[model samples]
Target: MRTLQVELGERSYPIYIGAGILDSIGELCAKHGISKKSPHLIVTDDKVGPHYLDSVVSRLKSEGYHVLTHVVPSGESSKSLDVYEQVMTTAIQAKLDRSSAVFALGGGVVGDLAGFVAATYMRGITFVQIPTTILAHDSSVGGKVAVNHPLAKNMIGAFHQPVMVLYDVDTLKSLPAREVSSGLAEMVKHGLILDKDFAYWCCENGHKLLALDAETLIHGLERGCAIKADVVSKDEREGGLRAILNLGHTIGHAIEAVGGYGRFLHGEAIAIGMAGSAMLAERLGRDESLYGETIRMLKAVNLPVQLPQDVSIDQIMDAMQHDKKFTEGQMVFIVPEAIGSVSIVKDVPVEAVRSVVEQLKGEG
Candidate 1:
């Protein structure tokens, strides 16, 4: 196993990444000081539970921790106020307290919802992440946690850090091809923002990833986590530089919400969003090959590079305005300057935004 640390002083924690790492989760958490005396809750979804829950529960129980689990239906809808409340009620009924720790044992949805539960439960309890998908490689590392709202994605959430993240690449083998492709979008985003070489690497190797090449995935995930961890360490609250992490998320979230959460997977939406962001930047007079390269690469993986033919511009515009990235009433967009390089843009021209979204819609 390889271990990397997110340096946040008092909130500092280590992330373990490797094949078959799930087997050592109990020993790992105990080493990190998660008390065995407190009740432990494993929050998972219906999809991930069958493959992972038993192994996790058995490990924790063997370590002398009283473990309980709350399984939510597997989908983005589970990250709602109603579900959050239901999980909260479960915690209360289980008699869990501040000392209790939450184990988010699935993908991004599970991590976001369960982390939020731990953050608000008795004013903050400990939580650990056992991410089961490639997408969670990004969401699992950053302390950003939240449930979605009708108006916007991840609107109701918090900056709750996990005590540790245990990523087992083996779980990915069981993921469907669609889920696998969806997850690669975030890794692509990570490369686009942090390293030019990494971005190109993802473009070259993404197809291999969908075929489940274990070595490529392990390498891709480690690099993705390192980039995210470095950024989160510097700006834990997204005060500045960390905004780069939202490279394609601003527009992506809008697309996801407008299409209805279940319509497009998070990464699918991101694939299109990143393509649009590149085109928007190009239209704004920032000439970069990233525009064409992003489009070409995303297409190679069968990821969408444009809005659906049926989506209306008005629907997307309405959703974008309500996006969390907006500041004081102005939109802040991340635009690519070159491969692996981006800058957050403000005062984006209305005409340029409309033109790009309209053009992308026409492409579909």
Candidate 2:
């Protein structure tokens, strides 16, 4: 097992990554100071419940911990206020208290929903993340929890860090082909924003990663998580240095909102958004090669680099207008300055963004 730390001083936490670590969750909980005397809630989804929920529940119960389970239907739609309220209702009836902790037992959706519950329940409680999807390697680490507002993705959210993050690589083996591609998009983003060699390394190892080779997959996930941990540790509140993490999120979140949170997965939307950011950089006359390089890296892992023709540019623009990143009538963008660096440009013109979106649609 490999352990990484999110050093926030008093609020710091540890991230444990390994194969078959789910069995040790109960012991880990006790080690992390989670009290067995309190009733705990485990929030998961229909898809994940059948596979690992029983084992998780059994493990916690064996350790003398009182457990409650709330399973929601899987997908982006579950991250809604309606569903959030339903889970809260369960928590209230179960009488979960401040000493209790919430365990997120599925993918990003479960993590976000459960974490939001933990954050707001009784004005905040402890939460743990057990991410089953590779795409969650990003979402599970950072404390950015939220339910969609229909108008924008993650519009209603908070920065509540987890007490610990338990990642069992075994969970990733069950992912479908498209999901694997979607997850790697964030791994690629990590490289693009911070590590040049790792960016190209991802491209070179695309086939191995897609095949789910144990060594390569774990290495990639560890690197991705480490990069995220390093960033969140320095700028816990996204005051300054942390905005770099939004490299593709500005356009990506808009795509999810315009799609009604159903068409593309989060990472897929971010893939196209990253491509658009590179193109935006080119439009600003930084470096023409950046676009081609970004596209190559995305294609290496089989991610979409262009917007679908059916998605209206006007609708995308309207969605961006509602994005939290949009302020004072100007679109904020994290434009790529190079393969491994980005600039948070706050005064981006609306027409330039439209031109880039149009150009993306024109790509074959």
Candidate 3:
């Protein structure tokens, strides 16, 4: 097992990544000071519940922790106010208290929803993340939790860090091909924004990652998590330096909103957004090669570098207008200055953004 720390002083936490570590969850919770006397809630989804819910419940119960499980239908749609209320109802009915902790037992959706519940329940409670999807490597670490508003992705959210993140690589083995590709987009984003060599390494090892090679996958996940941990530790509230983490999120969130949160997975939308960011970089005369390099890296993992033909540019623009990143009357963008660096440029002209979106749609 490999352990990484998100050093936030009093609020710091550990991230444990390994194969079959789910078996040790109960013991880990005990070690972390979670109360066995209090009722705990485990929020998952229909897809993850059948595979791991029973085992997780059994483990916690064996440790004398009163466990409650609530499974919602899987997908982006589950991250909604409606589901949040339903889970809150479950928690209320279960009589969860401040001493209780919420365990997120699925992918990013479960983590986001469960974390949001923990953040708002009784004004805040402890939460743990057990990420089962590759895309979750990004969402599970940062305390950024939210439910989507109709106008924008993650419009309703908070920065509530987890007590711990338990990642069992075994869970990733069951992911679908498209999901794998989607997850790689975030992994690649980590390198793209912070590590030049790592970015190139991702491209070179793309095939091994896609095949789920044990050593390569774990190493990549660790690096990705470490980068995120380092950033979150320094700028816990995204006051500065942390916005770099949103390298593709500006355009990406808009894509998800315009698509109604059902069309493209989060990472897929981010992939297109990153590609668009690179193009915007060139348009701003930063580096012409950035676009090609980013395209190569994204293509290495089979991520979409272009917007879908049917998605309307005007709709995407309207979605961006509602994005939290949109400041004043200008669009904020994370434009790549190089393969491994980005600049958070504000007040980007609307026409330039439209031009980039048009170009993205024109891509074959």
Candidate 4:
């Protein structure tokens, strides 16, 4: 087992990454003053609930903790005001309080929903993240929790860090290939923003990494989470440095909103968004080699580098305007100068944005 710590002064937490950590969740919580008699809310989805929820409940129950399970439909659509309300209702029925804890037992959706529930319940209770999907490697770490608004993705959320992140690699064995690809997009994003060597490592190890090679997945995820944890420690609220993590999120979130929440997975949309951002960088006279390498790497991993065929420039631009990156009515972009380096460019011209969007329109 490899352990990484998110150093947040008084709010410091440890992320335990390895196999079978899920079974030891009860003892971990106990270390934090939570015992089996404490009320524990296990939030998951229909797809993931069947696979591992029982184990968590059984473990907690064996330790004598009161456990309540709330399983929602499995998908991005569940990240909405309606679904958030339903989970809130379930928590109320479970008698959750300031002393209670919420354990998110699924992927990003469950993590976001459960974290938000914990953040707001009784004005905020502690929450632990037990992520089932590799995609949660990004969402699980940063405490950036939120349900989606109709206008934008993650527009409605908070910066509530998890008390503990118990990532069991064994849970990823059942994930589909597409899910694996989606998760790696963030790994690629992490490499692009922080470590050039890691970005190259991803492309070099692409096949084995996506094939669910245990060592590759564990090492890649630990590195990605460590990068994010370092960033969050410095800028927990995205005051400055943290925004770099939104490398592809601006155009990427727009792509997701245009697709009506279920069209593409989060990482898939970000894959295209990263491609678009890199194209915009190229238009600004950034290195051509970096642009080509990024696209090549994405394609090598079977990720989308273009918008959906039916999606248009106008639709994407309209959605982009709603992104949180905009300041003083100008859209801010986190552009890559090369893998491992990025620039925050604001007041980007619409014509310049259109040029890249136009190039990718029919390419899909």
| lDDT scores of the candidates, listed in order | 0.86, 0.90, 0.91, 0.86
* Model 4 worst lDDT window (10 residues): 322-331
Model 2 score (lDDT): 0.90
TM-score of 4: 0.95
TM-score of 2: 0.95
Q: What are the RMSD figures for all models against the true structure?
A: 1.9, 1.8, 1.8, 1.9
Model 2 per-residue lDDT tens digits across residues 54-150: 9999999999999999999999889999999999999999999999999999889999999999999999999999999888999988799999876
Q: Tens digits of per-residue lDDT for model 3 on 86-128?
A: 9999999999999999999989999999999999999999999
- Model 2 clashes, total count: 0
Backbone clashes, each candidate: 0, 0, 0, 2
Residue ranges of candidate 4 with Cα displaced over 4 Å:
324-330, 362-364
Q: What is the TM-score of each predicted model, taking all chains together?
A: 0.95, 0.95, 0.95, 0.95
Native-to-model Cα distance after best TM-score fit, residue 75 in candidate 3, in Å: 1.7
Summarize candidate 1's per-residue lDDT along 1-364 as a digit string, tens digits.
8888888899988889889999898789779888877788899999999998998999889988899999999988899999999999999998897788999999999999999999999989999999999999999987889998866668899999999999899998989888888998888888888787887888888778878787888888989999898998888888899989887777788788788777899899888889988998887788766689888767766688888789888888778877644555557788888778889898676556667788878742
lDDT of 4 by residue, 106-132 (tens): 999999988998888888899899998
Candidate 1: global Cα-lDDT?
A: 0.86
